[model samples]
Target: MATTTAPTTESLSDAVRRQSMAEAHTIQAMVDYRDAEMARTALIESSLRRKIERSAIALTIGEATGMSEARIQLRLSIADRVRDKTPQVWEAFVDGIIDFSRVRDISATIEKLHREESVARLENRVVGYAADHTGTELRQWLRRFVQRVEADLAVERADAARKDRHVAVAHGDDSMSWLNAYLPSHEAAAIEARLRKEARKPADPDDDRTVAQREADLLVGWCTDSDAATSAIDANIAVTVGADVLAGATPGFAESTDGCWAVPAPWLADVVATGGTFWHRIVVDPVSDDVLAHEYVGRFAPDTLAVALQFLHGVCQAPGCMVPAERCDLDHRIPHPAGPTTGDNMGPLCRRHHNLKGHGLLHWSTSPPAELIVIELYPPTPAVEMEYVAA
Candidate 1:
């Protein structure tokens, strides 16, 4: 038998690998270009919105309508954001391609039209209308179009209300505590029996009911007679990690898969150092187990975590605040024990920034593995003195 050939650098595999690497680089460059372009567009649009607020209101009949300057400013603000999509669809409304009786938010309608149809259709409609309509006439027609859209939306809301009912039940005590009393045991038992009957039925392929709806209905039955397995789910986990890849880089927090976003372990030096940091609590979606929002409580340790606070937050990260890292908290950009605790995923936050992040006033959106750079400063403060001095 002939000896089997061993792979060598000269084989076709080397060429294919080089080509794949080239393609990946090209794709990354394109993504970077697109992001830069989006940033530029956003800046331009912001400037235009400010200009419209200053000038557009002057053209409107505000005094007769009793619309305050602030109200006019607000409308223009909304208009400016929607202008790009609105102008393109203005002709569609005038020509009756879009049913004015059913549409709302002309900008949103235009966007849908373009996406559902084609850019060619949008371009053609605008060109055809531009030849016949004046800018002032177009604006007037759009105002009426918006009114029809609102009426249609109201009809939709009413229809949905007739289809599904939302019942809010108050659950008292901590989340880990057993389900609170709602109605009498007999009433609860009756509801549970009905839920089981629905759960037992085979799934209907043609049924309009969503998977979420089916799961929700099943969940009602699950609430009855809790077991060890059910109790384990009741204890949600939380974890803290840094925003950067390396540990102790940028502090942040995220909830664990279980939906519990715990405070960083007090034993972790970073957690103990940030005096102003606190336990940010949140009730997550039971099904998705995603955090909804943070409810903050002061729970920081003034020692131990000092070095981590210094490392992650050189200063306060809030937009306008300028507090130092020493006074800040070690915030898990993603939070821990509840979520992944990585070095680069952390952020240092002063009291002001901590409040902002907890309240959703300021948000931390992460990028992919390599380009996870912070746009805003963490613990916005003056540069700290380097710990080691050259001899």
Candidate 2:
């Protein structure tokens, strides 16, 4: 009988290597599939919102169609980060153009280190420890190690598609704005259904005062004090300008005293409450009944006032244009309405747009919209060009 020879050591080693490679490939494939699915689902969701009866139903469709809000968010974040990078870089990495072992080594390095500082320290430590282990010199090894770390992270990210754990609640009227997230399908459904019902409910008085009316009354009581009017004419009307200007320039001379503008009691007609802040509707002269600029007051630090302005503007101040609010600043066109150092009549304006306002080169037609203060700007050499429109 012929004796069966055992497999050679080289053959066994080759088999193990092939098995590991196959496993990694399988993981990578799964990751790719999930990523594609997430992108498709997001697109589908966007289109569906235009035709759907309610926004909640759209979310239900997403859940029923095998897409999770968490996964969608994860995919979006990953796409955003890598979107700026050259597509070729990501493509080569994803397609395994580079060695898988090198990719794995890079991933391990990146995962072990917490921050950039930590990574630098580790690189130094690794170079010293593996002084003789690697064939390449220390400097070369360090460079390779860092490259591997970044490559490894990319590979791992490709494999790690986000898991479906929640559903996102978006604005019904505006499908673009995300409102909140929901854990369970039933909860989302119930909330959406209830909102629709409430919206459809007929205007009928059941009690003495509505919730809105009661809240309005409470606000009126808080803001419009009876004794405030008498005290304002008789005693000094107190106005809190920025502490810096009050301390630095004129300590005792109040803004309400003479030449400087002071916010009158009656000018604060209707206290518009929005987003944990109060915007006072102040009329410049009560006799002429001419309304001046609407002032927004917040409890946040004065320097961080840009945040509030951005929130108000929602986008670029330029009318009918849709530039993002992120790149805008609170530019006081005609300086502070109250003549304070900060945050009186500032609106979110782009740099070029702000310069136009500051140089007095821009002409703004002030008009109050129902819910917002609309400013229409006209630049010189105008073909009726609209400059900046603030809310």
Model 2 RMSD vs true structure = 25.8
Candidate 1 local lDDT, 3-73, one digit each (tens): 98978866764564455445334323433443454454556557777555445333343553466656544
Which regions in candidate 1 have their CA more than 4 angstroms from the true location? 1-305, 340-342, 373-391
Score each candidate by Cα lDDT. 0.42, 0.41
Q: How accurate is candidate 2 locally (lDDT)?
A: 0.41
lDDT of 2 by residue, 294-360 (tens): 3343222143466766776778675564666668755654443322224435566677766766666
TM-score for candidate 1, please give it.
Answer: 0.20
Show the lowest summed lDDT stretch of 10 residues, model 2: 228-237
TM-score of each: 0.20, 0.21
Highest lDDT scorer: 1
Q: What is the lDDT of residue 234 in candidate 2?
A: 10
By summed lDDT, which 10 consecutive residues of candidate 1 come out lowest? 228-237
Which structure among the candidates has the greatest TM-score? 2
